[model samples]
Target chain A: MKNWSEKTLKRIWKGILVAVLLLIVFTFSPWVLVKGKIDPILFSMPYHLWVSILSTILLVVFTGIGGMVFYHLKLKTDPNANL
Target chain B: MTQYLLLIGVLYVGVLFFLSLRSRKEIKTSSDFMLGGAKIGLILGFMTFAATLFSTFTLMGMPDFSRNNGVGAWIFLAFSDAVMVFFILWFGFYLRKRVGSESFGGMSRLLQNCYQNKGVGYLYFIAVFLFLVPYVAIQIRGVAIFLIEAFPDFIPVWAWSVFIVVVMLLYSELGGLKAIIYADFMQGTLLLIVVWLVAMNCLDNVGGWSALFEQTANTQPDLLSPPGPKGLLSPQFLIASCIAIAMIPVTQPQLSTRLVIMKDYAALRRMAVAVGFFAILIIIPTVIIGLYGALQYADASTSSFLGSVLLREQHPAIAAVTIIGLFAAAMSTSDSQLFAMGNEFRGLIGSKGENNLTPIRIAIFVFAAAALLFSLVSSNELVLLARLSFSGTGIMGPMIILGILAKKPQGSFMIGLSAVALVIFIVSQLGWIPQQIFNMRLDLLLMILLSLGALINYYVKK
Candidate 1:
């Protein structure tokens, strides 16, 4: 039981690590600048504007899903696990 | 309109008073008073957390920030908040596992437990109070001026400020954290309903979302892009804002306590997701109102633009409810911080204070009075002041992360460095030093310095 709990905990941490890296790379990467464009209006908003709003929507969604899955599935496996 | 607004405002206060009066009886001990006995369920927890997180800043600051800074403002808050909710997952689990049903004394007490040095705990307390008191002061001031602008004839501005402090204190003093939490739920719901209605009206005036953007671009193209026309939302500024805001859940004592006080892990996780959803729904409307301001109220002062967008343009009825909503937002957040300060005092003095509720309440009153005095003296730039609060607290973020994650004592070295970092941040805030250090925003620079120092401190201890 302890071994299984350890594996589940390990996987959750790995998932968190990946999510953090993805956020840092896309949102704060100095190499990628998604601003200054105003001509290409996507669905009435500027490309940059739509992109910013969409990206935030995406981040919020991912956080919700990630939090739900981790807690409901892995963390539930062992109440005693030091998550 | 004024008469109707006055009626609704009184009704709202009456509702808040009833809630506080009923909940006050639950306070049998200091822990019950400070944390609601850690019995907060999922929905209530989510509502209070959302209410606390979304404050007058969203209603007043964001519309102004977007009007002044353009699309980059979304990156600053909406995205930053989404990221911060994820921090709750790890921070909550670790801290709860360590504390293990131990009534939370205060954040400083938690750090003391982790470091085993009361000095390090005191260092953390002093640094956070230095920054957070100003934070509480500015929130009070921000809404006081808003109310003043909303009602110019009634009592002077300073009187409005005093009223805000008194209302916040009474709300918390009556029922403690639970009262504040219930009030938050009411405030959060009112803010969401009223802001969205206001946004729809603004959008209708400017012609739907697409037309709003088209009009804005035609009139003010810079309002649609980065650095804005005012050159405010540069990449560095946006990135620093993201870091500062994202660190909030990890560093803010009021917020961290919410995580621990949840009924269980499942409740915490669900509450976090709810907060994230609330963040999106609450923020998107502010963007619309800001775009409306950009199109209609360009070249207007922030106060006049807010008065126009939130009041004159909407139905007088909505304009009135919004006043009540703004009052709710400011009180919800202000009371939480004030109460947290009181709790921190109780913890710092050592948690044997099972029967020391009166002294703690007295301490909270002193702090509340101090915040009121500071509010009268502070500036009126809402977003800038809010940003300063975030960054000042953000500088301490890594020390907290290190404390929670550390398996052993990392010693007094990091504590010494933390004081230095705090001083650098304070001096920069006071205009005594360059706002930017080495071409990066000073807050972000400080984060990097402390992070590296934490890494070294870890290895040295090993």
Candidate 2:
């Protein structure tokens, strides 16, 4: 049971990693930064800025989730892993 | 305003003095002084890490950068920082596991142990010194330039620089790493509050968020989009910036040392998340202030824009806090880097330098003196100079990552390759060579070459 759970968690962790990378790539893509697009503003911010802001906030959330998962794996592997 | 500045300044200094003396009482060994006994808690850990990372550049330089460059500055700094925090979650783990707190003297010593070559350690030290001194100098210079503007008749720029260095040296020498961490906690809090207060002030004056952007659109429509009005934030530039910033924890000794000193992986994990949140919260206000500068002081100089928005427009009490906050921001980062360099030097000298703190103390002083001299001559382009520092130190990322991850790194050839790359990058910065190779930035090209070299070295050994 422990082995199965660990394996499942590892897959979730890898998925999150890929998601974070994709978010970063999307943020810098041409669609978000089209030369002079200021329409479709949210919270009164321009297209590129608002989109990048959402990307940043999402990245932070993903980081928090990823940290918890990695910490769980470490604890399961080594109960005395203080260092 | 002057009176508020004096009162707040005195109180801030008093707190720094008390913290230093309190920390001094706890220091029993050199390790206790240099590494805070390698057991920092999550809150203090996050605060110090955030404080050291943000600094004068985030406070002064980013607003100026955004004002000139446009909203793409958000992608340039905040987005890059978000990526960096996630990077810490991954890199911090392997690094801690490999160094293992007990054997972790500094990156220089750790690389020496990994590669089994003294020259590797020496080269790492040289790269950090070359890049970091200018970085420290700029922080000091940033605040000094602001101070001379705020109080034109009060003191000269060089005098303000001297005063900042002296105060930084005093507290850091008195209490060492622990004292510096306490100072970082205070500075981080002050910086957050001051930045938000100033941002709100700017927002209110502009009639709110809608009007601010609307006005900015009416005036500088290009700022609201990417590649900016100046065409500075191209995709290539942003990608290169992301890579440099992501490598910060892996390469910068001060931040890397913070990763090792956390009490456990769990604290480091929590701290990473908190720092990510902190990065977002702090940078949003900088974007707001930059847009404010765009609408009101569009053609103003960097110093004039900062002086007007951060001081001339705010309430007197808030303006006072801004000055002290800027001072705290400068010292928090400068002291950390100067002290870390001292620890790096101690790591190089081996057992003979252990137990006695005198030589490390002197090294810290010498490093501060060198930074002081550099500040006197350095330019006012804080953000770009900071990027140069980041990319310069980042040239060593491949070597350091290999050192930490490999079981037995026989990549001594990497030492020479890194040195040649470092020299070429420096020469390019000096305009001795073109900054671009076939339309790609020289820094970007060199980073790619070094990573490829490290990969080949790793596979051959495998």
Point to the candidate with the largest DockQ.
2
Where does candidate 2 stray beyond 4 Å?
A: A1-4, A76-83, B101-103
Tell me the DockQ of each model, to 2 decimals.
0.53, 0.72
Cα-based lDDT at residue B8, candidate 2: 99
Collision pairs in model 1: none
Which ranges of candidate 1 are over 4 A from the true structure?
A1-16, A30-32, A72-83
**Candidate 1 lDDT over residue span B308-406, tens digit each:** 888888798999998899889888888888888788878888845667787788878987888888889887677787788788878778887788778
The DockQ-derived docking category for candidate 2 is medium
Q: For residues A1-83, what per-residue lDDT tens digits would candidate 1 score against the true structure?
A: 22346566567657866876686567655433455568667888876667666767776666666666566455555476343
